[model samples]
Structures are given as C-alpha cells and as structure tokens.
Target chain A: MKSEYLSEYDNIVRTMQLYIDGCKQGKSELMRPAFHPNASFFGYAGEQLAIGTQFLFDWIDKNGPAPNIEPRIVSVDILDSIAVVRLEVAEWSGKLAGSGVRMSDLFTLLKTPGGWKIIQKAFHWHAAEQRLAA
Target chain B: MPERNTPQKTLESWKQIAAYLDRSERTVRRWEATEGLPVHRHEHERQDTVFAYRHEIEAWSRLRTASPNPSSVDGADTDNLPAPTPIVNKYLVEHDAITRTMHRYIAGARAGDSDLMRSAFHPSATISGYCLGVEYTGSVEHVFQWIDENGPAPNINPRFARIEIIESIAVVHLEVQHWSGKLAGANARASDVFTLLKRNGEWKITHKLFHWHDQ
Candidate 1:
C-alpha cells in the first residue's frame, strides 16, 4: 500500500477500534466519534429488522459489557472517499452466561469533512443452529 | 395562505418523479399510461426525455385518489407547459449504473459465460467462498473458470436482497436459487455478497463472498 493509503488504513482501523471498545465497555459515548451524526443502521435482531443507530447505542447500554467477546476484522476495502469493512464478532455474552451471541457486521464509512465516520452499519446475528452447523 | 416566492419545482426524470410521489418508476410510468398523469415529454427527443411539475403531479394524485372518475389530462397542450429545469440527481443515476452492472453479472451467470461475467468485475477483483462444503479462496479467475466448467444455469432465480451505497463504495446482498453447478442434479441455493467500487466513472465488483446452502 502507498503511504497515503497506509495513513488512511490506520485511520479507518482507529475509527473501528472506537466502536469495538465501546462494545467492550458498554458505553455509547466511546463509540460516538466513530459514527457520522446522521449515520443509519440496518440489520436483523432475531427475526426483527433493527433500524437506526440509536437502537445500537441503546442495546450497547442495556447489554452492559462484553469483555470476553472476540472481534475479528475480516476485510477492509477502500476506494477514493468511501470504504467497507467486514467484521466477525463471536462469544458476545448476552443476558445468560455462555449465551454466546455471534454476529457478522458490514460497515460503510465515508471520508467526510470531519474525517472518516461510519455512515451505515448492516449486520446479521448468527443463530445457534447456523453456528453449530458452521 | 399567500403564494410563496419559490419557483415551481420540476422533476427531471422518471426516477425523481417516482421519488417525489413515493412510488416505483414502473408504477409511475404505468400511471402516466393509464391514469393520465401530467407528464410532459421533450419534443424531438427520446421517450425518456420527460419532466413534470410537482404541483401538477400533486393535483393529479389528489383527483385520482379522491374522485370516482378522474378526468383525463393526456391531450393537454405541451406548448403551454413551462420549460423544464433539469434536476440531474447524481445519486439516482449512479444507482441505475450500479444496477446495470449487477444485471450484467446475472446475465453472465444465466448463460454461463465467463467473458460476460468478467466485464462486471475489476481486473484485481478476488472471490472467496465455500463450494460443496469445501473452502475456496483465490482470484476471481477461479470463479470464472468454475462457471465455464459448470455450464449455464438458465433456470436460476436471482434476487437483489439489499444494495447499500455510500458515495463511491457499495455492498450488494444477492440471493440465488436453483444455481446448478458441479452437484449433478441437485440444484443449489447461494447467498452472495459483492463489494463494488466506482473507478474511472464505472462501477465494478471488487470482491465477492458467498455461501452455498445445503442441497
């Protein structure tokens, strides 16, 4: 990668880290800077279609912390002003201990005047049956 | 209420008009054909060279829904209509371009032509996925080769589950059924995820990941 892209790659990773840290700490404020003000969210929470970033923040707050969760950045594809990141999160503890909630998150980020901010987040929560099969 | 100083808003294309009316382009075009929507076409131009005023559309919408028998406005004089101020929405145009690129991929798959499918991808594109419970990760050429070997899937039904665009980058979720490959008579269902990038004014698939479900 070119030096310019290297810097951008670092910046993107830093932004994503904020989100992961927020999940680990269970505080939306930690991840607030990582997202654009008008950022939107779309994904399936069980059979329900979960929309809006507020829903994510509220869930993070309610679910408390997931200190033992493992998140892997599968891939990051960058263009001129936009990028997409695929992340696989596993072992996220839910209400019950060993409830292991795994998820696949696809995030779209834009290099706005304010810097790289996540514009959208689309996710899929892996069901127990699917996880066992995998 | 007093009249406002703002100029009469004109929608430049069928996409914009549909968006303003909160309907699909197909639905709005059907309305123009059957329900006498106030749409004006530019003379000496193609059929798609059309425009409509928001006020006119609003009036037609109200009458079409409220009245038992809505009067036709089809033969209205176009010479009297105000000149259209073109509002070229780049987002809508780009979305159409991306959709066309996806269609090329689908067309290629339906015919089992690797050359046709290659046109929709960037030269540096890569593909990673599982085929018949085996993990395969490599350049997109492997996929093209596999498609050529597997032959055409004329009966496959593909659906665009979701398309998320943010500026120059996009991600598409495609669901396909009856995708016949190396599994003999057992047609397979697959969920494909494509990441696309707009380069040199053209959108191309940069990467693809897929999962073939149990037969």
Candidate 2:
C-alpha cells in the first residue's frame, strides 16, 4: 500500500517538472499535460490584481522558448489527490532586468486519470532585499 | 404492533423536515442535492412524497458537528476513486478552519491580544502598508506589539471580501473599517490581502499587504 502511494507521489513530481519545463520552453503544449484546462492564476501586477491563466500564458509567450529565467521547486505537500507546490524563479533578463522582482508561485494540483494537473496558482512577488530570509 | 404515527419519530413532509432543521425548505432541498443530506423519497408508495427518519437526521447532525478537521479522518476513505461529495465535504471542513482563524485575527485586533494575533501568523510573516500616508513595513510580531502599545481601536470591523483556498494554501481579502486608534477622527478603510499556508497541520499567515483609504 505504501509503495502504491510512493509511485503516485513520483508521478505527481514528474507532472510538475513537465509544467516547469513547459514554462521555460514557452511551449504551452508542454505545460498542457500539467493543467486541468480550467486552471487559473491570481496575483498582483504592481498595484492591480492580475487574474486567469491568460496572464501567465501571455507572459510565457512574450518571453520564453530559449529562456534566461531559472525555476526551482522549493517544496511539495500532498494529501490524498490534492497537493500544493511552492516554486521559486530567478535569473531574470531583458525587460525584467534590474527590476529586482523575486517571484514565488504556489500551485494547487489534483491527481486525475491523466496524472497530476495544476488547478490554481497564487503568486508572491517581493523585492530582492525582502526575499523571505527563511 | 408498531405505532402508525410513531410519536415524533419521523418527518413525512418537506415542510416538517425544514422546520425540524430550522432551515427554509429551499435550503434543505439544496443541502440534500449538494451535501448528501439524508432525505429519502417515498418509492414504494408514490415517489412524490419525501420522508426523513428522525434517527438518520440526528446521526448525520452528529457527524457534521463531530469533525471539523479533515486530516483527522481515516486515510483509507480516500484511497479509492475520489468522490465529489467527500472531497467537497473535506474542503468545506478545512475552509471553516480558515474562517475561524480569520475571526481570531479580528478578535485579536479588537482587543490587542498580541499572543492571539501571533498565533494566526508565521513567525517570519511580514506586514506592509501606508499608515497616515507613510509607508511602513515590518514583521507580524512587530504589528502585534504595536497594537499592544497603542491600545485597541475603538471600532475595527473586518468583512471578508474574498477567500480562495487551493489545497494547503489560501488567500484572503479583508475589507476593514477602523476608527479611533492612531487616527481617531479620520476613520480609515483598508483593503488587506493575506497569504496563508497550512504547515504541520496548522494554518498561518505568511504575508500581509494592504492599501489604506482615509474616509
């Protein structure tokens, strides 16, 4: 029984890696397998609230495909079919150069017949100086 | 011989069930459809008439009040194909805990209970906002201490503007109306957004950002 759960956990991690790789490559198709199709994103773009996956897709379209940004999965917590992941990104360039914006993304995913798929994301942006000392 | 009426042992009509539950008929009907409320329709007789056993409703109520934390439930229940009812019920139970934490935050702010306020936040949590048109950024502990030093606000009411929960993470938007603290006559309204994470089977605010409006 424990082995079964462990295998499921590995599958979830692999699905998440696909999502990160997709964003890095600016290939929506790569990320397609990692999302539930009705997934959404929420965060602040300056003082305004940015909503929906379109914002994320637009940003990826404008800047990836041979990307300069680096992403790392910081943590993952799973309970049954639902899971939460924390991802951090750095090594920004181009229009984002010297903006000093540090991004941390929290994602909610569920295990589906197709494997694990992200259903929602909430982002936290901070200044380089204030990057959570923890 | 068994008694026919059964002396308050069963509810035979929707009206009676609704009244027994102290809810509107519409609400009870919605609960039956959505939350799997134990309501049985007469199939042997006419299928149109609805009836609910008193013992069944009582047992269901006991279960509802018995478990407020989803983590306490047995894991074997979730091992099979995920059912919508159980999943939704688990989320609802977890959501209640989040709201309860928010309410504790409000109570802490009103009474300047730094300890209670601190319990709602992670030790490293930071708060940032403009106070009297000046930018102030500091740790959550600092804010709690500040509340203690300055005394309670005469009136500080926070209404939930929005709450989103995704697995173990949550985002809460609070619209606050505060009067009589540092700014007595001005009476301010603020929009506060809190980012929270469930860690070690507990929820804590990790960050807070707000915009203040003088009114």
Q: What does candidate 1's lDDT look like per residue over B1-215, in tens digits?
A: 11222354888778878767656676665465434566765533212266888888766654443322243333432112233343366775577567667776776676677765777887767665556656555578988887788777766657887787654457887888767655324467777777776666677786676666766
TM-scores of the candidates in the order shown: 0.42, 0.42
Residue pairs in candidate 1 whose N, alpha carbon or C atoms collide under 3 angstroms: none
What DockQ results for candidate 1? 0.03
lDDT tens digits, residues B1-215, model 2? 11323468889887888777666676565445323456665533212367889887665554443333343233332212112233347776677567656765665665555654666776656665555566555567667876677566536656787677755568777877653465333356666667676666566776665566656
Judge the docking of candidate 2 as incorrect, acceptable, medium or high: incorrect
Clashing pairs in model 2? none
lDDT of each: 0.69, 0.62
Model 2 spans with C-alpha error above 4 angstroms: A1-134, B1-88, B183-186
Q: State the local distance difference test value for candidate 2.
A: 0.62
Please tell me how candidate 1 rates in CAPRI terms. Answer: incorrect
TM-score, chain A only, candidate 2, equals: 0.79
TM-score of chain B of 1: 0.59
